[model samples]
Target: MVVFGKELYKIKSDRYKKARGGWSRIIKLHCVECGEYLFDYQKDGAGILKRLYFDRIFKELPKKPLKCKCGQLLGIPIIYKKEERPAIRLFSGVVKK
Candidate 1:
């Protein structure tokens, strides 16, 4: 597990391919109190790639809380594949007010 600011993130690789292909597990946590989100990813059971990517995204994010319309903080947990590297697929939906 990796701690980033107020959130916790972790990644675990499941399988690997010969030609540099693999499945990675991503876990992200959002802190309602701090209104911050932590993103994580891993490849071939290694965290190097995930760490670098997380660091880059964190630096690019604004120093502001990401809150819902009702003032509740929003946290998104996403899964991404190398084939879809930059795009995150949401496994859950937001709660309805």
Candidate 2:
């Protein structure tokens, strides 16, 4: 696990390629309420992060409703209907890039 700031993240080393836009950047997700580091994410396209794919998360996360250490609600675990992939639906203004 790679330590960043005060948090530990298990970096994902496997490379993933998309038919469309490839992996763009790796961004550190932070808690909005406390500004604490949440996790590292491999974001594909630009713009707001509405959902976080499980495979893109670089750290192990708790099951079900994912929350920050400060108890602030971040996202809910769900299967994205369109892609049929497991992902976390992030709440608005709960997290920052």
Candidate 3:
């Protein structure tokens, strides 16, 4: 759930190892509104909505309204609004349990 963009934000880089290559960058974009996870791994870039961007196709997403196929309306609910942190962080040692 680590949302990355302008800051070179680090999630579990150890977890996202195969997330390499130009335009082949794999990412899991979480929807704050629908509570779903989307991917940027497919070769077909248009498979997911660009408004969701995944930090690749679009620079920002707060203004974008998402229409999930499941009929959930969501988007980058935290972007352009506040500095929100991921609900969970792995290996970075935020876990206390």
Candidate 4:
């Protein structure tokens, strides 16, 4: 991916256990520079081409910078380390009921 000269993005979306019609997922991708909302695509995860589609988009990284409607740089983070990716921490210690 580095060959593309673009920042890497770890997927921030959650995994769905069951999809009614098919394996549907709401993909949430943010700009690496400004952390702005890049685009949210609703897709069928079961399609064979779908995997290739996503890989082509993320791996290549669309010039790596999304622009606002005004044409200004959104400044999303270009590079993200493993630690920089966000995670959901359920509990830190014992839970009280």
Clashing pairs in 2: none
lDDT of 1 by residue, 1-97 (tens): 6564465655333333223455444444443444444443333443333212323242244434434445664433233455433322222333220
In model 1, where is the ten-residue run with the lowest total lDDT? 88-97
RMSD of 4: 14.6
**Candidate 2 deviant stretches above 4 angstroms:** 1-20
lDDT of each: 0.38, 0.79, 0.33, 0.35
As for lDDT, the candidate ahead, 3 or 4, is 4
Better of 2 and 4 by lDDT: 2
Ranking by TM-score: 2, 4, 3, 1
Alpha carbon lDDT at 96, candidate 2: 85
**Best of the candidates, lDDT:** 2
What TM-score does model 4 achieve against the real structure?
0.26
Predicted candidate 2 versus true structure: per-residue lDDT over 51-85, tens digit per residue: 89898887777658998899998889999997788
On a 0 to 100 scale, what is the lDDT of residue 64 in model 1? Answer: 42
Off by over 4 Å in 1: 1-21, 30-35, 39-44, 47-50, 54-97
lDDT of 3 by residue, 3-92 (tens): 444334333233223433323333544544455554332222323333222333223333344444555554333332232321111122
Name the 10 consecutive residues with the lowest summed lDDT in model 3: 88-97
TM-score against truth, every candidate: 0.21, 0.78, 0.24, 0.26
lDDT of 2 at 1: 66
Q: Say which candidate scores most in TM-score.
A: 2
lDDT of 3 at 7: 31
